[model samples]
Target: MMCDLETGICGPAGEGNSEMELIDLTAPTKKIDLYYVTDPICSHCWALEPTLRKFLEEYGQYINLHTLMGGLLEKWDGFADVSNGISGPGDVAGHWREVGDHTRMPIDGSFWFEDPVTSSYIPSRVYKVVQQKDASLAPVFLRKAREAVFPFNKNISNDQLLIDIVNSIGLNGEEIVKESHLPAAQESLQEDFIMAGRLGVRGFPTIIFLNEEQKGVKVVGARPYDNYVQALKQILPEENIQPKAINTLQHVLQKEGLLFSREIEELYNLAQQDVAAFVEKELAADSYIVEEVLGEKYIQLNQ
Candidate 1:
């Protein structure tokens, strides 16, 4: 089974749903490993940011998370399998608009119309290179890639754009560009692709939760917060499962230097009808974070 976050729906990626199976409750206790298979340009993967952040925050102590790149779109030349015969950027842009409506995630579909990406390989390779340089910086760089494509309308496939992202993250852009072509980077990406194939992954944002015995419980799709909690409980029933309450805005601001209103809403499980207004009010009162609008309204810690 696969979960496409872009459509906020869980279904078989292709052919059959044979991969979906119940976790073995009798499995021995061991450290959980979460392999997050996703593509940079996958709108559903972008939509999963909040759920991912919450997952890491709550179960980080009990689980080890590994992000693997799933090459979603290799090329657009012969790609016509998407809904409504997606042949060009215009069709993809329309799909992104629909995803934004469904997930309530900030997505400026203008990227496809303004500066369309021909392939997802370039950014995926760049991610591998970043991981090679400094493994910790990988997540930040991935977020930058998403921001560039979805909100800023930048072509991440371009070398210059990739360089800009590297520099923006305080990394050695020149070194990254210089070694981006190294065989190791390509090998790392290939390994991810091979592993994805072995795991029967066919969609974006497919999270596989594995135990010490390598037994896995797959969570497919952009599901609600409860789905993730339930999956974790099923996998590691012996471990304490307390989801920390994000009771204050300061907690979020201090942890993540930058903040989005939607992120806060999802992180806190806020039931407020107008999450934007609530976030705006919080930002207005906070003396620590300064708000800015870059396609979407966001807050950064006042440095």
Candidate 2:
């Protein structure tokens, strides 16, 4: 699904017609770069986490992955759409519930029902601040923010709530807060918007593979793991491609900390019917992981 940064709504990617022309590249580079265009609160983006995690685990050494924020929602005002039957936060909760049911992703819709977020800009800006401080830690912070909203039902728009999430992730909250409001942080966020527009990105969870010559392939919306692999291979045909096999449950848990049956199925290309049973059987006999059914079944490494 595509999320409009200007309207702050989710719809099919490239739903509306675009008048912009594609930019031509000069030459191909020696290395490939993966530009991941996403929004913090985008459900489709959240659903693609497993595939993304697996992609990074396998091809991290060969590719440079850049996470760019797609401004999903600017503000709640001036948004009134009765066509799709989504008018307010309550409607959004229902939509989220449907997404969770379809994707098997754990999403607590109470945040939309109880305390709706006014804007996604706050978290998007905060991400730029964290990226500026330490690029590697930015992904961890983003994961925590997603967990807070999706599973924990926490409103991350609140300044204090955002700070709490930063602190919980072992980052200096005070430093993050101080840097988040700086001119440079705002500029960094603006740059993401400009880059998205330049790339003609109309969706969240969009993956663009660009080689040194600037030749690129754009994959929009959340697709299968093989789709991503194909995109990478298309960009880097000469590179030796070695697909990693999922050997044990511990390996998955060590990489993701938390595991969903759907995630395992997608990562390993397992059949849907066997996924739940396999996860349950593994958790039943294993001492390192614990399974919890909070609306949906989730497994995490036992500490």
Candidate 3:
């Protein structure tokens, strides 16, 4: 069902135990559609969230984005054999902290220490359930779960936790709980896993693109924004887009997360001092650009 990547480990690209390929080319289109396949419990997937959000904000109009669930670490039985308990929940606490520091993303390591999760499938499947009722709510619920476990240190594997997340997001908690337990929701998740199989997806964070004719290109792992852009370009060469240059720095600062002087210098061909002054003026106007007075004049995207 899976294949081996260049590495010997059974990669999503590899056809190993999975009966399906990780990406399927059945849907044909002239324009490109990107299927972002990931699981909620995947740490790397969490790291990609901000980048993904930005990418969507910038380029979503050029492409159709779809979300899919790929089951990661389903069987806990055989993990102990090779992992020697290293892959278990008990070991994830330190790993999460290390990754949190590495990525500079705020992740509370206390979830693994306080209440470990048994499986990611439960929450992942719940995403499918929510999607059925309201497709827009799927990603919202998924992010809520991530916030609960990673930043808030709550146990998402607990039923009450899921209910609370549903409630926090202004959804009907009782209905979400009821739908999560329903047979249809489970079946939808099963189909998503099956579809992942056919697509040859081997990892947690995968973006598979299909053009109008359904030509496919797959990207794996937590890569930079350019990688995603390149993948889309490969699929949709006709869509030639350039970032618009504006007079005031506010629009650019609002669109992009942080603006380094060097980046602005390159973008608008402004001298470093001019860019610095422009940024400062924006900050003075309270236009969402703030310069922290710590070390460097850090410009933040307040919006």
TM-score of each: 0.81, 0.79, 0.70
Give the local distance difference test score of model 2.
0.77
Encode model 1's per-residue lDDT on 128-177: one tens digit a residue. Answer: 88998888889889998888787667788888888999998879887886
Candidate-wise lDDT, in order: 0.77, 0.77, 0.69
Models ranked on lDDT: 2, 1, 3
lDDT of 3 by residue, 224-249 (tens): 77888788778877666543224356
Candidate 3 has an lDDT of 0.69
The model with the greatest lDDT is: 2
Q: What is the lDDT for 50 in model 2?
A: 79
Distance from true location, Cα of 121 in model 2, Å:
1.1
Please count the clashing residue pairs in each candidate, in the order shown: 3, 6, 31
As for lDDT, the candidate ahead, 1 or 3, is 1
Candidate achieving the largest TM-score: 1
What TM value does model 2 have? Answer: 0.79
